[model samples]
Target: MGITKTLNDDLIANRSEVSIAEFEASRRLGAREGVGGAASWAVWGNENDDLTIFEDSAAISPRLRKDVVLIGANFGLGGDTGEFPPFKNFHARKSGGDSKLRKAITGTALEGAFLTDIVKDYPTKDAKGLPTEIKSGTLDTNRYVLSGFKTEQEALGLSRDTLYIPMGDTTRILWDLLVDRGVIPAEQRVFHRAYGNGPLFKERPVTYLRHYAGAVDMVQAVQGLLAQLNLR
Candidate 1:
């Protein structure tokens, strides 16, 4: 039989090994100073546009509103009639592929930081106009992931006036529980802007939450994570 990419023995053998290798290399670090800095937490997300965003009048502050509008304008925000925009940098630290492994390790560090400590959830309303806790308040950053975005830089449009949190395993667990309880359907649990490996939406939890947070932030984190892989 002719060989195909998936049918190759070497490719399959190497895939599992790569994951384990990543895990082992991460372990050698013992602990990482993840998430507190822009570089650390940024990897929790990947690129996309089409996240839910509020107009300047709806979100929190004027300065943020100004930033949002300006950023959006740069992207031709609402015009919906322009060529795709250029890649803008967030001034973050990391870049490159292998971001998944780096983000996972960084997450380990964040969980350790949050253990036994409960952070306050700033209140925000859901689509139902009912009060919803922003949740994961313990991450100590006002940022949360923005769903329904269409591009990585598009995340910036959501951040100008509202806080976003990068969703983590913890928050994802919370979302699952919400689904199980029928609080919302499993489909509602994710933002449906980009296609995953297939037609399904991919759930990437990294997000920009603080003023320093954005698409640029995620790119930086990815860079930092890839850099760490050099040790392995």
Candidate 2:
């Protein structure tokens, strides 16, 4: 097949190449090199406390299939280079003061279209040491920590035709722009429900595209996805 009829348009628009030296520097720690049965709709979420969802949607596209892998690195918090702060600061925090800081940080990071978080309910401690319910809003500054891997998985689900690749802690957003533009068949938009076996081959039918951990993984996964579909 020519570039896999099912490939997404966003994945086609942003494919590129890089040096081997760059590739080695981007691999993630503890990322194993084994393939298994692909879950058609695996959604990643941070701990229950930080339940951010990652998936393919018009709002959060997973720019599937490309040669270049995108990855994210942490520069620190409250600065231009770090990952976004918790959703409370980015979205729900009151206006002005730290709000400006959060906006500045988010705007800079999201300039190229990266996915982040939104505020949610979390647990808190009361004066008597009893567990209390606290909205993400009331946390003191610095209480919000960047989310982790499981959280990333909870937000996004991968199946036969779709995969969730993380660019840093943020899931690289992807949309079915092909469907939006009416380029691909409407029935091919598999993200709305579970992916079917029609997209798979052999036992290891689903292929996950990834690269070096952190920022590089995102680029590598996109590249891998493109290469795979192009061969189809």
TM-score against truth, every candidate = 0.21, 0.23
lDDT of 2: 0.25
Deviation of model 2 at 135, angstroms: 16
lDDT of 1 by residue, 1-232 (tens): 9533211122123221112332232222212122111111112224322112111222212111111110110111112211112111111124332233234334322211111001111122121211133233332222322211211223222232221222333433443444454443444313111111211112332221111222335334432322221110
Model 2 Cα RMSD, 1 decimal? 18.2
Per-residue lDDT tens digits for candidate 2, residues 193-227, read 22223234323333432212223333333333333
Model 1: CA > 4 A from native: 1-166, 189-194, 198-217, 220-232
Residue 88 in candidate 1 has what lDDT?
A: 15
Question: What lDDT does candidate 2 reach at residue 103?
Answer: 28
| Candidate 2 wrongly placed segments (more than 4 Å) | 1-3, 6-111, 118-219, 227-232
- Model 2, residue 58: what's the lDDT? 35
